[model samples]
Target chain A: MIQLTDIQRDFQVGDQQVHALRDINLQVAAGEYISIMGPSGSGKSTLLNMIGLLDQPTAGHYQLDGQDVTTLSDEQQARTRREKIGFVFQFFHLVPRLTAAQNIALPLVLAGMSEKERNKKVTQALTQMGIADRAEHRPDQLSGGQRQRVAIARATVIGPAVLLADEPTGNLDSASGIEVVKILEQLNTNGLTLLVVTHDEALGKRARRRIHMKDGLIEHDTLQNHPSLANP
Target chain B: MKTRDATRFAFDALRGYRTRTLLMLLAMSIGVASVLVLTSLGEAARRYVTGEFASLGTNLIIVLPGKSETTGGGSPNLLGGTTRDLTLNDALAVSRSSLINHMAPLIIGSAPVSVRNLQRDVMVVGTTSSLLDVRQWHLGKGQFLPETDIDRASFVTVLGSTLKQELFGAKNALGEWVRIGDRRFRVVGIMAAQGRSFDIDVENVAFVPVASAQMLFNTQSLFRILLDTRSRESIPRAIEHIRRTLRERHQGEEDVTIITQDAVLATFDKILRALTLTVAGIAAISLAVAGILIMNVMLVAVSQRTTEIGLLKALGAPRRQIIRLIMTEAALLSSMGAGLGLLVGQIGSNLIGYFYPALPLGAPWWAFVAAIGVALGTGLLFSLLPARRAAQLDPVQALARR
Candidate 1:
């Protein structure tokens, strides 16, 4: 489970303080599928960044899977991010210099796994994402849908419990976007806690729980179909 | 991250900027190679001078006519203007010391030599027959100067190979009569061609008796006294004894300077080593320039790769890992440059050795170690600023930095 209590984030733009997030309180159960919908400047990205440990909240307590992680050291937070949370982006964020397979193997490499084990896991991830045939291709050589598939493979290769995606299909055509959404949903069905921050109403409604944000505050929180929360 | 994976990632970055990588490597290698080559030349010069000194015979000491160290200094002593002249007796007296090995009193001048109307001006060295033993110079034909009393004025002479060739070409030089200056002398011996020494052509001079040379030059003063000590360890004692003996002979005045071959050689060794290091330092300045180039290029690279660094952060790489990544790239470039520089340096040394086999032109081991160490050190040290900036970038700002 992920919990945020009274989270506040401020940015100093020029001489005045700008609130990027304010009094945000939320809970995400394990294996839950949630979407955050808001217009530009709604602080949805900042919230996702905070949950992924990419940014720090100005004030608040954050607990991921029941452990307060708000005050973790940088290295400790990096380790927590590596082991428990993964991120996907609208750009796919593939390293252009690496092949599709090497991209997926990066997290395993960071974790210092044995070559034999990393190779096995990377191969499995490639096959699972249906990009086995494209494993040796660099990102520029792949289509938008294929690139996102590679990114998905890379994000989940370490088997993180929670996956946070921001504008995951913002750059893709509708046809490719649908394929990416289906892949993300399948991973959620397999018991990964999935959080999607987006502007698409159709994709937002597909999530079991949805939160609406405006001007750095949450406007609504509703559950369409609650997810199973008791998987070991 | 595994060190191997980090290294591979750094190499990929380097490969991405192929032109910049090549330029840095070129600059670094040139710096290292210049240091190696210049130091090798300096070392070889020192060695060559040392070898020449060794060839002058072992444990040798030279006695010159003037005191080189002028205590009550007026104007500097004019070259060749001595307060007093060393005589033949002074050399003979110095020879009497049991610690003295051998003595050869020398008188040197140049005059014309003629045989059957063939004439050329040739340098003449006046010394006793002990000169052959003192100098360890071999006779090519016939016996050397006859052993006679120091004042006996023997009219016989020995011809060097070049003088013999000039004055008695295709004739039996040992039996020929040559007119030196206004005197007629019989050539009793001819010397082998020994190379030049102390700027004088050893094979282009005639050898004659000391008294005869005094008669020929109209001077009773000996030019210089050359002698050896009984053993290497007895050199200092020999010099002290000779100095005391000479001071007494000159009426309590130290009118001459004694030069030990070892001391002169050591001084030259020190001077040459200092020169080598100075030039090596100048070459090291080029390494500093290359290091600055690395810093400039890397700073630019950090901003250009902001997104990638942000991605690395998102993928759970710590700040230390990011620093390591940049440093590894710098290290790889420097180490490679050092390697290539050494190869070029060794090749340069080999080329010098090939063209001048007697030069002894090979870089010392310290040159190798120091060059590599400084290049790598400069590379890593200069990369710190860029590495810090890369590590300190905010992940969100970096990701959004297009």
Candidate 2:
């Protein structure tokens, strides 16, 4: 579950103040699949970063799983992020020097997981992402879709409750984009909470719950039954 | 994060960027190696000088004519005009002191000694038979000059091993009459090869009676009076006695300079030790330059890896973990460089010792410890700015960067 009330984010470019997010309020239940769509600079990404605990709100209240996370210390926030949230960036952000398997094992390593258990989980994630044969490949050595899959595996390998994907398929080709979306959908179907921020209308519409933003404010929030989810 | 994982992560990062790592290693290794090699060279010079002084006999003192003038004064009295000459009588008077053990009045000059068709220009040392005991020299053939009265000009000479070989060939040099500076003197002894004493080649000199040398050199003053004390502890008392005796014999004037053997050694030791530290300090500057290089390189690396740092932070690495990773990388590189420099320095010193066996060049244990400690310290210290920059980086901006 996630909650945000009167969340305001401001940026100072030079002399003038820029409002990136203004008076935003939202709430979502566990295991919900949601998409946040907007034009550039519409505060969609800023909202996702706030929810991911990567940025502090200029003025707001944020609660995650009944804890007021806005009041948490930096260390406690990091721990909460480690234990409860995962982020998949548009750039895939895979450490270029690490192999796909090592990339997926990073969160576990940060959590001080034993090598044996880390290797086991990494292998399972590599298999589940269907990048098992490409486990030894570096990010630069993989195709756009495979790299995104590795990034996704890295995000979800720690089995976090919420997954935040900011344009996960933004850099991929049409087929690869569809495949990544399907993998994300599969995870969501398995009861993982997924919040995707994207500019693609079709991808945004595929979510069960959708929110649209304009001028640093959410203009619409609605739930819809996607035909594919009904059939599967 | 686990230390093992942090270490491996740092190592892998360094390996991924080979040129940066190698450049840092090169700077650090050169710094450490130069410090070691330079200090060893200084150490060897000190050792060589100390060894030479040790060989020049202990508990000894020398009295020279003329006071050593340290200040610049054009006054005639301060010049050599009024300086009293150290003479045989002065040496005899000093010798009578109860604190004195043996005394040798020395007058040194260069003269050609001829034996039949063979002649070689040799340093002539003028002294009594006690010179042998005072210098701790051994006779390879017959006896040293016989001890006679201070006024007696005995026509006796001692041939150094080299001079005897050149003049007498394989024949017995003892009892041979050699012409030295237009005077024929019987050779009473052939000195054993004693290598070098101070700056003079001991094996190339010829020794004669003090009176005979005074006559040959046409001077009433002795060059120096060499004295041995009863024991090491008696040298101070003996020096005071000689000063009083010489002052009494020289119209109540203290014109002669009394130099205790330990004083000369101590002065040289202080000078050379300071010189060594100076050179070592100069070498240490190179280490500072190396540390600056590390700082510059690490600064560049943090910017280059901003995205990676952000990713690590996103994956829940704490600020300390990030610092640990960066610092560990720098620390590992410098320690490896230090290890390499130690090996190179040992090899370099050994090679120097092998070619020139006289200077036993070995870095003192403290040099090794200080070099390594300083290398690691500088490495960590200089990398701190970049590590802090990396740790404090905003994960959002960093991840947002390409």
Candidate 3:
């Protein structure tokens, strides 16, 4: 679960001031699947970045599991991000020098897990993602869909409570994009909260909740009851 | 992150750019090599000067005609303008002072000497038979001029070892008649070889009685007075006595220079040390330039590896780790260079000694340690800029870059 109160982010571009996020307030409970839809400069990525702890807000507070993360030190923030949140980017951001297994093992490595435990966990995650055969291959050697799958495996390898994806399938083909969405949907089905920031209406509509943003503000936050969640 | 893990990562990164690392190493190696070579040259020169001084007689003093202006002016030279023409009287006075063991008035000149139609320029040293005893000049064949020869002005000469070899080959030159500047003199003995002194071949000289030399050369003045003390500890008192005696004889004028073996050797050592320092200083500049080259190369590397730095930071690597990683690369380059330089320097020093036996190149362990210290310090100093740059990069901005 995450909470945001009156979040505002400002950027200085040369002489002019730009409002990236303005007076934004939002919350999500456990196992919630939320999609943030907006045009360019609508603060979707900015909000996602804030929730991911990759950037800080110029004003207001963010509470992650009841702790005020906005006032945390850089190191503390990084530790929180490392332990509780995982990011899946549109660019796949897998270290080019590391193999899929190493990429997937990164979160655990940051947490100071033993090599043996890391290897075991990475193996299990690879098998779980159906990418076990390609575990030893580097990102450049893998296809776009395979790279995205590897990215997902890396994101969820640490068993974080929340997954934040920013245009995760933006660079993939439709079929690959659908495959990545299905994988994300499956992770969501397993009780992991998923937040996807996207411009694709059809993809955004599939989430149980859709927050449409514009001009640095959240214009709408709509929740749809999912048949799967209802049954579970 | 742990230091071991950081070192491993650094090593891997360096391995990734092997050629670049090698180039940086080569630059630093050149610096270390320059320092080693120049410093070794200095060390050799100092040893050579010290050895040369040792070869000259210790506890012995030479009283020259004119005092050096640097030591302050006193009595003017009697022979020429500045050289003293100390007589046998001055020598006798110093000898009777109880501080002296042996003393002699010496006159030095060069003339063409011929033996059996073979002629060569020979240094002619004129002194009493006591000169031979004071200098430890032993006779290999026949006998030197006796005390009676100085009283009688005997036309007898003692041939140096090389002179005998040159004129007589393997044959006997002793007791043979040799012509010196048109005067025929009998070679009564051949002096044993004394090797090189002050770069001159000491064996190429001829010795004759001082009385005969004065008559032959038409000079009544003496060029120098040589004195030997009974013991090394008595040299300073003997020198003080001679200085006081000379000052009294020359009316309190310090014109005549009293140069002891120790003073001459000390002066030689000072000159050699200064020369070594100057050469070493110049070479140190090249080393500094080499350090600069390392810094420049490391700066470029830091810039090129910016993305890598960002990736590491994003992976939860602390700023100190990034700094350590960059510094390790620099230290690795410098230390390797220093090792190679030590090898190169040792070989260079040995080669110098091999070619010139007079110049001894002794590279002590401290020199090697100094080389390493210099290299490591240079590495740390030069790496500061790049390390700071790497540490100061924004992780988010860095991660954003392709």
Candidate 4:
């Protein structure tokens, strides 16, 4: 349900043009669980961001669910992102002032959903994330794992088609990281397309299909019949 | 996003940054309050001046001997101007106009008056008995000068309340004789206490018959002629008729200046109204300053909330929605500040009114509306740049910020 052809992203760092993503091509079907792994500056995060519609490719074509999304207007891109993409950032990015439920309800509010429906969806998200009791707490009041869970809930509350996680468990402890990964795996099992970008070898190995990158180019791509439970 | 939700979001943001919000509110409210209070003060001064002019009898006219320069011709005030003394006959001739209801020839001078052992220098006003009615000054005791011919030199005089008090403290002064400029005159009336009018202390002056004042001052020219028209409609006709008669009597030369009290009042009215507007404009500058303050604070707020803005954009909020959110916050702060300022200004005005009860210190309705409108307008206008900056923020760059 995702396609990229000759996608090239370049950044200008002072006087030189740095190619963040060079001649990237990828395709993935719906319900696929994939992990992109690389060292820093390998453009793995840039690829996920491109797939999430947060960044534009300098030279390329991107198709999402049969629509050529690379040609969409900024407004259309935002609409597509709203309707078909969800993102969980390493930093969580929860509005510090909003409570857990309110943070989850943000996408619904932006979609002009009625207050009643927004509250219902927020409550369901809280329950689905297993943080129903912490819905009233702000981001600062929550632990690292709980904050990540809230961020996940916010990402999925709108029922987007693809979930993009950039270092989902990067900041969590070992126990909480395992729990968060299990939750993401459970959602993937329920047929949600999940693409995770991480530098952790063990977490990357848990995916059904894995891609490794070095210097803005994919080094390897492999599909394992039986995913290894290297860490969990 | 729904407007209500946007507003609520903006409000929450403001509440989150309470100190910044409060400082902006204070600046805005102080600006509006100054506008209201300054305008009210200006309006009060205008009203006070207007009231003082209203105290001068309506339909009253004054005839001065020398014409003001603006009326044209050789300047009557200049030494070479064809200026002529206005005599009793000229006053008598002007009195013949059918439009003129009552006329009083006036002579003003300073002279030393003594009652036995007590002596003091005092202002002396000479006018006919009709001066009492024309000036609307009431007598505290005894009677005013009898109505007689204009040239009749009556020995009767009227003592102003203060002069009477100074000359004969606890004693009756109605029948007392006082020597004024070496002439003995009997006090026929004691004027009621009049503080001051047009900078002249009426309470310290003495009044005598016009003919007697002419004889005492050794001059035939009347200082001024005060006239009261039959009605408000008769004033223009009375002025025209007096000008014609005076011109005829003064060798057909229009040397006298005839000014209606309304014209003088209108001039003062126009000046005071302009003054009020000027002060109010000066006060509105403070509102612009407040607008700049809002812009600065909003810019800081946008920077501080960079991540939150990026998150909102990521959540699918449009650029216009982001702008609307910031604009709503600024508008809310402005309206609240304007409301609070109105309250404070009214309180300040009431306090001033309480202390100085004579001045009508009410702010005009337009001032109130303009103050609020300007506050809201400036607040919105100034916040536009910051709102636009917030809207233009790249979601990727913003989210990437620590």
Clashing pairs in 4: none
Cα miss at B102, model 1 (Å)? 2.2
The 10-residue segment with the lowest total lDDT in model 1 chain B: B73-82
Any runs in candidate 3 off by more than 4 Å, and if so which? A94-162, A170-193, A198-207, A227-232, B69-84, B96-105, B116-118, B127-154, B158-172, B188-195, B245-255, B364-369
Every model: Cα RMSD to truth? 3.7, 3.3, 4.4, 2.4
Per-residue accuracy of model 1 over B1-402 as CA lDDT, tens digit each: 899988998998898889988988898898888889988988898888888878788788999998888775563454334578899889888989999888999999998888878898988888998887777788899999887788889889998888788777777887778899999999999988887765457778888899999999999998899999879999989999999999898888788989988988899889989988988889888878888888888888898889999988898988888899999989898888888889888898899899999898988888888889989999999999999999999999877654
Residue B248, candidate 4: C-alpha displacement in angstroms: 2.2
User: What's the lDDT for residue B179 in model 2?
Assistant: 96
- Please, what is the TM-score per model? 0.92, 0.90, 0.83, 0.94
| Order by DockQ, highest first | 2, 4, 1, 3
Best by TM-score: 4
lDDT for every model? 0.88, 0.89, 0.79, 0.89
Count of clashing residue pairs in every prediction: 0, 0, 4, 0
**Candidate 1 local lDDT, residue B83:** 78
Give residue A59's lDDT in candidate 4 (0 to 100): 98
Prediction 2 TM-score vs. true: 0.90
Where model 1 places Cα greater than 4 Å from the true spot, the runs are A226-232, B70-82, B112-122, B141-143, B159-179, B188-190
Better of 2 and 3 by lDDT: 2
What would the per-residue lDDT of candidate 4 be over residues B64-86, giving only the tens digit for each residue? 99777455545555646567899
DockQ, every prediction: 0.65, 0.68, 0.31, 0.66
Better of 1 and 3 by TM-score: 1
Q: If both were scored by DockQ, which would come out higher, candidate 2 or candidate 4? A: 2
What is the per-residue lDDT of model 2 for residues B173-285, given as tens digits with 9 covering 90 to 100? 88889999989999988888888888568789988888898889998888888899989999988988988888888887677888988999999999988888887888788
Where does model 3 sit among the CAPRI classes?
acceptable
